[model samples]
Target: MENVSVLEERKDFILYKQNGCSGNGMRCDANSVSGAVSQRACVYCGARVVLNPITDAFHIVHGPIGCASYTWDIRGSLSSGEDLYRNSFSTDLRESDIIFGGEKRLTAAIEEIATKHQPKLIFVYATCIVGVIGDDVDAVCKTMSKKYQIRVIPVKSPGFSGNKSVGYKMACNAIMELIKSEKPAKRKGVNILGDFNLAGEMWIIKDYLKRIGISVISGFTGDSNYENLLESPAATLNVVQCAGSSTYLANRMEEEMGIPFIKVSFFGIEDTTSSLIRIAEALQDEEARQKAIAFTKEETSKITPLVERYKKNLTGKKAAIYVGGGFKAISLIRQFDFLGVETVVVGTQTGKKEDYDIIESLVSKDTVILDDANPAELEKFMKEKQADILVGGVKERPLAYKLGIAFCDHNHERKHPLSGFDGMINFVKEINGSINNPVWKYMEESL
Candidate 1:
């Protein structure tokens, strides 16, 4: 048999050539090449992805309308409190506002919003334009905080200054500020970090915890509000999911509040079960562990048939993956196996070395892995590798479709919950649906 490798010609990517194409460093990081449409989003996007799930707080985008328009309610964070945060409140800075200064308009917007909504908190997100215009968002927020007698925090999330990781830091700073305002409450409950209740995934996991007799203090951003967040220190433990977005916050919380956190994943069957068990064990309670066992058994049994059926149809298919975090890339390698699919090419925007190691261990010897991959690299790899489908976010979706390949929505914008036992079934259904589409036949013919 021939060595069927998919090495391409003339691309700036280094991941595939060095360090064995595992979703980690050696391929890319914060360094951006001139004029490249890198698959990674801006810093504001990163911060927005992390914080937009707070649900109740008034989140105002302090920039031109585009930033607000692009990120309006983009995450799957479910709202259990006031839905005011979901509203897109952009300063809509026009050319004139940019020149004279946006401080006055921003002040009016804040006062108007405060008078109308009387929200518990208001978060002003600075965008690329705001950073450029030098708007004094902090000063304005401070003044408004006094006038409204509410917490008004300013998030510095400029798009071009750095990549999304910087935004994560900005969001964490805002969250930390929110934590500082209230007294810490000690309780049996724990904080679930990075589990935005997208499609109610947080709600689903919360239910499982409740079934195991565990109380939840709050989620990091998903379905979270100001009051619950301040009480995060009261929780006994923190379960960190989506570590790329929440680990910094968790570490900060641990350092400041004497709370410990554990890394967890709730995507695939294996990850979800393991996460439940890990959380139970972290609490160090016998009753919780036993209840977790029973809960896991029941959910596993219920999901087996669905996984099996999807496995039958999706087995032996080839997939190209592009995602945001290393944890997801790692979990997805396992998820693909459950459906009998092989990941030929996999990559992420911000996967660490440890994550790459896990991805390398999961895949076949010749699989392609990449970090901070651009559209050009992805297109080159997918086409050359003969992958049938691609799994990625909105930016990559259109590119994948343009090349006549199938895609899955694994990003924050997805409407459905892809967590828990039911999520396992939905995962199967989504994968199977894409793999079995009749459009592939047409694509093959055109190719």
Candidate 2:
């Protein structure tokens, strides 16, 4: 028999070792191994992903075109207002600017964007080059704000400084400053934090909350605009998802605005039911509690059958999961369990220690669990683990396809929402299509 083993692999220890993580013992928060094509994006990416859901805000990139180009409308946050947030704007920094300075170009670009869009606010983001060139974005934003009488917020998200979580904190800081500009009001509502409204996921959650008689003041950035964010301080409570990203915003809102925050997830049926109940219970409104129960019952019936059908097809297939946050990985493990699939390999880019604690417990022994994995590592581990399908974001998708393995996209770029009742069904369909495709037969024949 010809060696039927492209799957046979050497154990790349740094790439494969799940335990004895070097960073855990050492000062590991250093720039990731250079030239590894690390899946973790730049600091600007971290900041932008957290803030770009503000549909009316002009999210101007005050740096090279690459930064904006890579992230342009990559998320699926549905907007209820102006769609200005969808377009990516850049100073389009050139070689001359890199050697000289990009400040003037940035100022002109902002002025031009303002003239064209007349946006209520403009968030000017700084990149690695801008950080090095030392463009006074704050000074420029202040001058522009005064001249146009608009809010020009400067985001200090230099790519090299740290990771995506740091950028998320930066986004939260910008929102805090904006909320401070408006007068506070008594809140009859809560803000949904960390939901980017991808394919109307935020809307589904908002509808559920509304039916339960709880006023969702506004989603942090999902379908959110300047006016909605201005009212964020008024919300009595904050329910945060994707804690790796938005937990900072919720914490700051609580400290500065007197609004308490609760961590929640609305992924699988179990998580969605618990989260809905928790939010309703926190309100202490009986009507909300009753409404949540009805929503849960209705959705469970709708989704359970769909899950069962997929489970029947997906029963024995194993999966490899590499996501951005540990919370997502945690939820995915549960979701895979619901589908009767085993997760053979799992990892995250910006997961916390406590998050690792939860994930480690959920996974089986010898299941490779790593942190801040690069392409080489992901490729090696996925093959070594003999995973049938790989679930990850844009960067990881191609690798999976190249290897002739099935893939599921569970990232910001997805057009469909993967939250609540509808999401569960959609998730099933997507996975099923990929796993049981006619193309796989061709791939098998080629193999």
Candidate 3:
């Protein structure tokens, strides 16, 4: 609407700047436009993010070294046990392999890693070139599985195939292969899906659930090892935190294993309280429900006073969001609301129609909602909205700084935990620190 100099094809990718524009809903979940510089990561990135948290798995990038190098230890998923998932393995495919086939080289790489590590599980990710060169990654994985008597999962995540959401589904499919359990759920248990234990956030949630008489069968991947994943089918229900990545896995588990799922978020006080209650209600555990209510009250009481202090300085601040998924954007909107910050522009790399619908309903009428946004689009919307702060991943941080806007790290690589009551306090601290920093005054004076 605002004659932004975006490619004609990308015009539909941006909205809500025109006169009387509501920005309620716009197109989303489509592949990134060619040469648009979209913030969306590759399909392999999606797969890697979802599966890379398995603490004992040997993750192999079946392509060039760049893919593995860039994604190596990309997430701050802390492990309580095995730290094997931290290493990045790759075939380092060259022009020669692209011309012929990298299957042989892939076999050799798997063999090499298997011989040394003797890992029980290995996830082999197919990159863009592997898809182009027609490497049978599944066959290679299958052969290696038999040879080593391990689970060699093939993640068919060609970067060019689709956007990050496609990669999430790809990762979920691969994880589904490893979930094989015939025994019924023995304990009052649930599988935590999509919370990748970033900064031990998963551990925090697990502790709260334990106090409420629930046992965590396993996290979808965060701190979850091969054995934990194999036992995931035994859980009675699945609690999905990051819906964009783990929804498919939850649905599949429900259908195949008869394990029902409930979407939950632990990002803020409101979501955390409600999510705990939802889990208890789903399990029909009155004692757990009571404990969850008591815990919510106790936790909120301790943090509310501190959070209000930060809110006093942060109130009326406008923010922009460009994150990986829709659920996080939705949670941030509510979290910001709790802090009295208005989200003027929000977008996701791979949010679905339903996600956008919920996001539109949550924001103000004139707020912009975009899908698969490029840096230019983010800059234009953030500037147009006069936003004071931007919450995004590493890639978007520099852009926010160059624009003289405050930034917060809400992505995979963030070391600080941003979940539960403690996370709400952290969130407030981050906002207050960024928005009230003294450097901005100098920046404004110089500008």
Best-performing candidate as measured by TM-score:
3
lDDT of each: 0.83, 0.83, 0.89
Q: Whose lDDT is higher: candidate 1's or candidate 3's?
A: 3
**TM-score of each candidate structure, all chains considered together:** 0.93, 0.92, 0.96
Give the per-residue lDDT digits (tens) of candidate 3, residues 1-447.
655666788777665634443445577778889888888888899999888998988899999999999899999999989998899999999999999899999999999988987889889999999989899998989999999998899999999998788999999998887874445555668999999999999999999999889999889889998777777787888999999999999999899888899998898999999999999999999999999999999999998889988889988999999888888999999999988999999999878888887887788867887888888888988888899999999999999999999999999999999999888888889989999999999999998
Give the Cα-based TM-score of candidate 1 against the true structure.
0.93
- Write one digit per residue (lDDT tens) for candidate 1, span 331-441: 888899877899999998877677777777788766777777778778878887888889999889998888888888988879888888878888788888887899888
Itemize residue pairs with steric clashes in candidate 2.
Answer: none
* Number of clashes recorded per candidate: 3, 0, 0
Give the Å shift of residue 181 in candidate 1: 4.3
